[model samples]
Target chain A: MTDDLPPLLLGRLNHVGIACPSIDDTIAMYARLFGATVSTPPFDLPAQGVRVAFIDVANSQLELIEPLGPDSPIHGFLKKNPAGGQHHVCFEVADIIAARDAMRARGATVLGSGEPRIGAHGVPIIFVHPRDTGGVLIELMATPDHY
Target chain B: MTDDLPPLLLGRLNHVGIACPSIDDTIAMYARLFGATVSTPPFDLPAQGVRVAFIDVANSQLELIEPLGPDSPIHGFLKKNPAGGQHHVCFEVADIIAARDAMRARGATVLGSGEPRIGAHGVPIIFVHPRDTGGVLIELMATPDHY
Candidate 1:
């Protein structure tokens, strides 16, 4: 099926999502160890059931996500890992809908409602199932407003 | 303890390592699904006990690693996952020794013999323990030649 279609317009990695029990501790580690500047006061995403912050790196950002509550999506992961771990890796795409359609055409499974929803970045985003992505939950998000 | 020490010089992400049972299947999926152009032919890193390949993305690379044998370090990961999963995430550093020392000073545990070893990229590299890295095994490698 390798035909004349253009390659996926995946932009630079926006951020890597790390699920942690305490965003404060993680932020402290980055600050003390790497001198990373973190976005102030994590904001809660009730729809996503997580609180998120960003640690600005040289070229990209590291997203720290903490479960908002027991029913949070990342709560199960934190329960199993306790200390938490890499949750998902996000990449930027020029057009999220086109990316989703391309993935769907190739039989890739989009998670959740299988439609693009406004993500934490306030851009359209869709998650590809881990099974279809070699066990890594992959999130494709439209390029951020500033980018 | 944020004292009078220099911060770690972590460069842009070099790649995200994915441990896969079959690089061929993974490559095919990326090609068909994302039209990703993968580097041709997998290469063996005997010392690392894994076969590796790279899929170049717009800004970074996706490293695909497969166990070379039962003794392969990734063998255990594949056994647990059966399919495959994200194994590690690697970032480039300006200096290996400086980064190592900074991490050590900050109480981060360095894996292996506690010294940098030649990694798959033929550059000095060290793995930081997941315990100290928010449950994510982090690889710090000297910036590759020409990169």
Candidate 2:
């Protein structure tokens, strides 16, 4: 809040996650309309509870995630947004645990076990509860160097 | 869709538009949690039917839109998501008219008057109907060069 204090994280938007019931159809739509292509096909991350594919853009990427099982994390989101929509937004952080601590200290709620988990990128990440964020899920991933 | 065909646009994600009932509260939350400092501050755009502010990140930006008048374009969205949410994703296109024609040729509906209009960044932009983009609102703006 002060002009003298620098931001806690780099604040780089790594990706925007989209909850897709069908990743293949989403891929086709993006390509046919925007010429946006996806190279790395969808891969299942059972631990993460979804199948994800990345669509590269000039700076950030669009992450397409499809429910993998009945207990998929995005199941509720899809139930509400049946046509699929932006699910969450990911940002790069300097220190996963420290950022987590700082946020918690400020009365922010970190989703899950309140600890870092290996994200689909194999980087440590944590989700900030949307209730504290005006109903938008926020993911903070450790910088690649930290990983 | 093919390796040979490059995207029609720069594929740069211009910004993710967020419909906010109160931009002030959203700005405060971002700064408190992510330390996302928005230096330029919020300003009104009567013609666009909303007040706007840009939060800069590492690569892309997040746009906060606060409806201005009774018929503000975002009134319907706020009624659905009072806490606010990501409304649309924008990408940079090399040729607005060409891209519009291309998508129309493919049967994707372009919203508005089907012509480029000046966006908040003072760039020419148009919205692609959500029905065509898997229920996600997509905005295609003329790349800086074309603008």
Q: What digit string (tens of lDDT, one per residue) describes model 2 on residues A15-41?
A: 899999899999988887777788568
DockQ for every model comes to: 0.57, 0.64
Candidate 1 lDDT, tens digit per residue, A58-105?
677788999996789898888767988878889999888899988888
Runs of candidate 1 with Cα error greater than 4 angstroms are A4-6, B1-6
Considering every candidate listed, which one attains the maximal lDDT?
Answer: 2
Cα lDDT for residue B109, model 1?
91
- Cα lDDT tens digits, model 2, B54-114, are 9888788899999999989899998988999889999988788888888788798998789
Candidate 2: deviation at residue A118, Å?
0.8
Residue B62's lDDT within candidate 1 is 87
Docking class of 2: medium
lDDT of 2: 0.85
